[model samples]
Target: MDEGANIPQYKLFINPFDLKELKRDIWIDDPIPAQLKVDGKRLEIDISYRGSHIRDFSKKSYQISFYKPNMFKGSKQIHLNAEYKDPSIIRNKLSFDFFSELGVLSPQSQHVLLTLNGKFEGVYLEIESVDQHFLKRRNLPTGSIFYAVDGDANFSLMSDLDKEIKKSLELGYERKFGPATEDFFLQEFIIKINTIPVPEFEKEIPKYVDVDKYLRWIAGIIFTANYDGFVHNYALYRNRETKLFEVIPWDYDATWGRDVNGKVMEANYVPIEGFNTLTARLLNVESFRRKYRNLLEDIMKKQFTLEFMIPRAEKLLQLIRPYVLQDPYKKQNIDQFDQELEVISNYIKERRNYLQRKLAKLN
Candidate 1:
């Protein structure tokens, strides 16, 4: 919400064509090695598999694979974020550590300070790319779907795994994607979510410890109204010999109200193709309240408990602390994160009451 440029947030500006602007919308024309180009310098990548959610600027192709961040990592692909301003980079860098705290499986990450044109830019948490083999086991298609949505509200209308698997379903899911706001950041939203079906022909899915754990972590993510968790945001890993499965969380840029807002905005565009009105997708407060109560109990037992989340949160804060700047531009970014962290950490009891009150009235 704050809009002034500061030192840590903006060191140098990048051309859209520049390598650092690798946020997800661009396309690749060829099948060059899946390396990332940072500040015009190309780093060889471990995996050339193109991302299914975003285009390969070189290959113009989509694969459920990994592309390395085009920066310097020396031997490791994972890095924690340190400091700076770009909003796009800011969110994911924070997420890299946050999910780890929640015990969500994901690539190892490290912090990287990015500078464009010599100015102190924002921070980035460079992560190691996950393997593509996991997707194959899920019976997920190899190439990308023609049109996939990352955590789309429309997909919620379809039967989720809880129902198909016969697990007790939580009614707390939100519907903020309904007909409301016009000019939604649809393109950017794509990076974090995508929908694909489990292949019907593939029978008898393999058992993997991480899959179950990942699902619960994802539920915890949504329980807190964290919506950056789309199907694509998660990936599975399989041991070639054991055939075990693991799920890894990716792309936290859209979590924590990134995809939602209060009910007052006007809309010029309906979210989906056929819906005539926008009222259908508004967040249903009743469902959230019900679902949240159940999820909270579980968080205490599992994900966000003192044994699980606190250490990670403390570690994350420590990891992200140095990169957090007191500088002019970066301060706003840090402040935004700090404000959210406070809301979730210290003010939750009060905030929960307020949120419940608002939800009760809104519904």
Candidate 2:
């Protein structure tokens, strides 16, 4: 980790001293092993390994990202690829299977215990490293860590799309709501939400989840019952060599159902209120209503009725039952995760209509 540059420093995470101790004691039989620093000392976990490096501190999953040498730190970096692995925290294989089945493209991971330096400490989600060809074409410095780098595109959010999606028959990742970490405001918000216009083509007015690929994806998410997959979480990476864009889905920690005791519902998925300086302003409440009013109407109309969303959610929960029950320190609280999922799921399913109506009325 050559002391990453462009990497935003964040407030420290809740140190896992207690969890480390628990991991050390039980990791021999566990899938991933881990060791603890005495007294929660200043120790950083390297979240990279192999041809992959991790973007830690993001409001995303506990993951080690796989990438080619193009993104950053090609061949010389102390990434978490070799960090502490406590087999106990690794997601089961079924998680990957279910995600793939849902049309999401994520690296495959198998549970494995980690041995940090000489100590037993954590687990690893040994994933298949993604080819570097899939990222924005750039030769990153040994340690630059900026997100949203577009080395090849015109770099304008408005003009970067290929001719295919530019005609407006298909929508490619329109940023309706900026990340919660962004600073909020009316100008940026308007740009974020109302950027899309109704195409001149009346026959195909930018179908909501109506695009063939995304329609299948919507079906997949409804089937898998994991709504964590969003435009930001998904991307259409253009292969420089192939000159073609392919959509891939990422992040799945919110999969399976919310926990049984109901804590996960309140805790797992957060509303926009928790954001800091940058992301808080990204939600273009007014513009989102205007550009996506009709679509929101459709989702709201069918969001409920347990048949559409519940069965898939339940199926995912059943598949991950073993993993939810295996956390040594119970760091991945099953009940808490469950409650969060249910709350967010129901919100997206039901509240979407009212919210859409609000957006539709915006100036």
Candidate 3:
């Protein structure tokens, strides 16, 4: 087992459970028995496989949706992110912290020492699930919530038509609220953005999407260099009052100088133009492009500096260091942990310079 942190440790016990079934790449509809001990309280929970990729591997992640609401810190559900592919094991939590600190509506994350059925499961990042509870707490209006599961959620014209016609769940979006299982509201929303003329699109877009939040979200992704986030790996919701779609970020393990597969990425890998057709079209408007460029410059100047980031990274590294070294399921060598942090610190410096150069050419 890993050394315990001063923070609350999550002790989960699964009983009458099939270990083989838990390791399979499928979500069993049935709830498996589990006991959760946290913050001096013990609660029973039903756990299940919650991710598309990590489930297929030996090291697993899970969704802990409590049998009762508010069972855990008023959150109905939380994600135990194994972070198997992240050598540093800090990118997801750090990127999220960066966003939240910048006042963006992003998920909150904390590091937890996890033990499953008496065995250490590594240092997992416990992330707040973007559900009804999350929206209520932030005072954000909620209508329908959809998660982008794969590349098909790229906000392209063709993908929009296919979703409307086929209503394929495999099109990479699953509604978490407000809409029925086969709702076309999300599909139609995408079609509206993809088909409308640029001028009309710009005019009507605010009716369906929060342009400021969307720009800031994209700016954060560009600064963080999260390749997976552009087309997928986010949650989109519509506000009933505004009837506008907004987004919250999710699944950030593959960020901050690494690809989704954990390979080292070039410091200048991401361009200032950002990713996805949505950003490209928005940037086509000169005013919008200027605003986006200003956002990048402001983030680099004000928030994402080494003085601000390094200490936070150091503190988290210290907090989870013991657990990471002791966890039996960790994929990276103990030495790589420090190495990865240094790489990220350096990437931050290089990325700032790269963005400065790109912003200079924006005119």
List model 1 lDDT by residue over 154-247, tens digit each.
2233334344321211112221212222113222122112222233111222232223453444443443343434433554333334434344
CA error at residue 11 for candidate 1, angstroms: 12
- For model 1, the superposed segments whose C-alpha errors exceed 4 Å read 1-103, 132-211, 228-230, 242-246, 256-298, 301-329, 332-338, 346-363
Q: Which 10-residue window in model 1 sums to the lowest lDDT?
A: 269-278
Model 3 lDDT tens row, 1-363:
644746458998876445555655365655565778887778878788767767766677878878744457778888988888888778899989888766678888888888887887778888999888888878877677888877778777545435544355237687787758425767677777677798776677677678888988888888888877878879888887787788788988878888888898887777778767777788888787888878777888888899988888888888887787787776358888878768888889888888877886666
Per-residue error at 280 for model 1, in Å?
Answer: 21
Report per-prediction Cα RMSD to one decimal: 13.3, 14.6, 2.8
**TM-score per candidate:** 0.44, 0.37, 0.91
Q: Choose 1 or 2, whichever is better by TM-score.
A: 1
Clashes of 2: 54
Model 1 score (lDDT): 0.36
Error of 3 at 104 (Å): 2.0
Candidate 3: stretches off by over 4 Å: 1-3, 24-30, 68-70, 160-170, 181-184
lDDT tens string, model 2, 201-284?
222222211233333333334322343443333444333333223344443434333321212332224321222111122223
State how far residue 308 of model 3 sits from its true place (Å).
1.7
